[model samples]
Target: MEEKRQTALVTGASSGIGRETAIKLAGKGFQVIAAARRMERLEELARQVQGILPRRVDLSDIEDREKFCQYLSDLPEPVSVLVNNAGYSIRGAIEDVSLNDAKRLFEVNLFGLIRVTQACLPGMRALRFGTIVNISSMAGKFAFPMSGVYAASKYAVEAVSDALRIEVRPFGIRVVAIRPGFIATEFNDVGNEMTGDLLARTDPDYKPVYQASGAGVGKMFVNATVPGPELIADIILEAVMSDAPKTAYSAGFMSKVFLEQRATLDDDAFDRFLTETTGLTDLKV
Candidate 1:
């Protein structure tokens, strides 16, 4: 029997996990809407995969995001699957990141996700069956040195996912959180660029702290085998395609090791472990 064509929306679909997931979903006979700030890339992806509808929207902008959400709400076919994957990271100590910058980060990483979900929820509830996959980072579990801003946003995502999962389950809406760690993507380079030269502008006392943590992180990844976005895209696809997907799935490099440590350790002990792991415990400036 021929099945009804289902629509799937993937935010941040211009690149990395979003891009890959869009391709995979389309290949599985989904009508995929690929949304991102980069229209050219989305266009390219549409060319690469037939049946992908390229959409350009800057999720960080309130006017633009609302317009996009309205479009989602008005879709002829309700979005049966949604991947809230648009987010970026800026490296800095909590004291270093400006309030304006932090607010902007949350606007995209947290607020945008929440608003988009809101727009889709009505349609999903009307249908009484849908899947929401939120791409939360492993940082959602614990903070790392100089990553407080990004981690805070993911932490908020974790909280929302937990609450929404139960709230919407009665409606047959499933929410799944995918926590990735250090995947091989332009994500790291983009984060570095967005953060700018951190040590150059930070307080002199923070220089050594940054250097030591950088070195600590560098050393840790020296022998690690970083996987590509396909690994995570595959997980997202599984969650979307499953009859009863798990509430959460962890993948990519360092996800298991770090999340396990965070799960097992108590507060003070975890604090020490994180500081030591990031080479900040012995840092003096």
Candidate 2:
């Protein structure tokens, strides 16, 4: 007997985890609606995968998101999976980063995700079975010095997902948060680019600590055998297909390690560990 093909909507599908997840889902017999701000890249992805239907969607734009949702609601088949994966990081000390940048990060990472999920929920509710995979980072669990705003946004995601998971469970909807560690993606490069100006303007007293933390993070990403985004995609696939999926799945080796350490370490110990690891200390400039 041929299995029914489910429709999946993947945001941020132009690159990294979203792109990989869309391809993986399509390969697993899903009709994937790959949505991203980059139409050209989505077009290229469509050509690369048989089941992909490339659609341009900028989640940051309210009108664009509304139109995209309307299109999905009117689809012949209801979307069975929604991957909320569009987000970026702004790496800088909290004091150094502009409030505008922080707000922009939340707009895309938190509010945009909420809006898209809200649009999709009606369809998922009507269908009575769906999975929402939210891409959260290990940073969501622990705040790092240069990435506080990014971590704060992800922490918001975690809280939202937790509440949404409980609220939607009765309707046969499943919510899974995939927390990935240092995956080899363009995220670091983008973060560096976004924070360049802010870092340059940082207070001289805090500059060394910020620079040291950034260097440590850079080395962690470079030297650590961080799995690629495809691993996260695979985990999402598992979460989507399982009859009783876990509410959260840590997707990389380091993610698992950190999560475990978070569980075992006391607040003071963890702070000390972070300070030692990132070279952050109370030093007089």
Highest lDDT: give the candidate number.
1
TM-score of each: 0.98, 0.94
lDDT of each: 0.94, 0.87
lDDT of 2 by residue, 171-231 (tens): 9999999899878888878787877876468788877787778666566666467778999
Candidate 1, residues 1-285, lDDT tens digits: the string is 988899999999999999999999999999999999989999998988987999999988999999999999899999999999999999999899999989999999999999999999999999999999999999999999899999999999999999999999999999999999989988989898888998889999888988999998888888778999999999999999899899899998888889999899999999998888888887676
lDDT of 1 at 139: 96
Instruction: Score candidate 1 by lDDT.
Output: 0.94
Whole-model lDDT for model 2 versus the true structure? 0.87
Q: In model 2, which regions exceed 4 Å deviation?
A: 1-4, 218-222
lDDT of 2 at 74: 87
lDDT value, residue 27 of candidate 1: 96
Shift of residue 31 alpha carbon in model 2, Å: 0.6
The candidate that achieves the highest TM-score relative to the unseen native structure: 1
